[model samples]
Target: MATKNNVVAFQYPRLTKENYDKWSLIMKTVLGAQGFWENVEKGYTEHDVAVMLNQSQKEASQNERKKDKNALMVIHQGLDDDMFKKVANATSSKQAWDTLQKFFEGVSRVKKVRLQNLRGEFKKLEMLDKKSISDYFGRVLNIVNQMKRLGESMQDCRVVEKILHSVNSDFNHVVVVIEELNKDLESMTIDELSGSLQAHEQ
Candidate 1:
């Protein structure tokens, strides 16, 4: 068993002289036992490969656009909602970015503390791998088809069709952003997308 010390001296039956002596000897036999941080530092620096990996991980983490991902996901997920009701409605891009960053910061903090408790809930979910662009486009096509059907039913079908066309254009713009992100991901040193997914969870 391990214990964290908060005081120089404290009464403890568990620290009886005999057990204390044995524990002290045992601890000394352990490598780099001067302090817990010494052990932690040693562990993180043990091998050259490990050191390089850690450096890369840190660099990747430094460039993470976690907050950006969260905002994009938020906007995409909120597409069906009235835009005027969202935080982005009244704010400039900079202001909206700040707000979204704050929101995700809190979200990330909450997740950090409880991830262990929640990890199991995701263990049983099946992952869907990317099949084909056409398969991906199917959902988008479905929406287009639905809009076309709705446009036909309206008395002002032309007006409704125009609205659908505008929506399709917007979808195209979003697709461009998605494609840019995907391409940027390939050359990027680290998986900031994963950070963004973490933000999504947030």
Candidate 2:
């Protein structure tokens, strides 16, 4: 009997190409807090009519089904027509959730291709001449973050090494000093490396 507005007090943003990640996170958090996230993730299984269920079991099953319907309604209310159609045929909240992920989370094929392209960009990233240290770091961090969002595994050490190698020759002396001083490059954080580079640049 709970309406979508009554089930969720706050307005949940509709999912879009640019907002899918943020929207998905917020929706999951809200649903989880309401004890409906399991229905979305794993779905509710109907009890077999052939087996006689105790009164408590029957009541629990009915409650689970209600929760499933509510979860589906929450998802439906948050999507635009185009997005809604993606999961309109789903029989359960789990099916609807998986369908949405397939469409918006970039299917395996698309994600793989994107990951490759991002890796290439990361490899080609260099601190250009005349670019400030902060600007250069920002460029690198942008690529790193994009890679992370796409599920690529980027270690801090890998990023530190990449930045150290990519900076212009103006930073050659400092880079060498850092390499010598820090025998274990893996222990150096990006921020620490950036601070050292910024100091040299100034």
Candidate 3:
């Protein structure tokens, strides 16, 4: 079995015809870690921002150039033939990155609309009669996870508040007491809330 990782890497999502948001967000982080994000964000030849590469990269040492190649290689690894073909003509890593950006510019709006729908679904979710706290949380997290996948910046406080508000009447007293005593809802985690609620149930 694979050993557990303490520092989990951001998953490198593959460039797909329909998933530009996920792919670009993760790929940008991976590239950023290697110091090539600057070149990609601001081209090598274009030096308005000369933080990474300067003046057509005339100032770039061989080591910096190699880093650029490594960044390009990683981008290629995450692409399929069709996607790669679009960036094939790009000489610099930035050129390749920009080509894909232009291709997926329309996806940003679609992601927002999908996230709006998820918000509605989450608000409508509730704990049903006879459902364990664990089970109810599972339902809540399903929608939460989907929103997160679409780049929603969901906070723990919001999730905790939603759970407390939507719990069955069986948990009404406990939810009231929890909200009253734990005024700092932002600091309360789902695990802490669930454990408290489950203890009350038992």
lDDT of 3 by residue, 52-121 (tens): 6555565556556677777888889789999899999887788889888877775677878999999999
lDDT of each: 0.35, 0.89, 0.84
**Candidate numbers, best lDDT first, in rank order:** 2, 3, 1
lDDT string, candidate 2, 31-145, tens digits: 9988999899887777789989899988988999999999988888889998888888987888888888878656656877988999999999999999999999999999899
Report the Cα lDDT for candidate 2. Answer: 0.89
User: Which prediction has more favorable TM-score, 1 or 2?
Assistant: 2
What residue pairs clash in candidate 1, if any at all?
Answer: none
TM-score of each prediction:
0.18, 0.54, 0.55
- Model 1 CA RMSD to the hidden true structure, in angstroms: 28.1
Q: List the pairs of residues colliding in candidate 3.
A: none
lDDT (10s digit) by residue, model 1, range 27-136: 33331232332222222221344455566776654333343333333333322343223444522323343344455556556645555333332232222343332332
Q: Which portions of model 1 miss their true places by more than 4 Å?
A: 1-84, 117-202
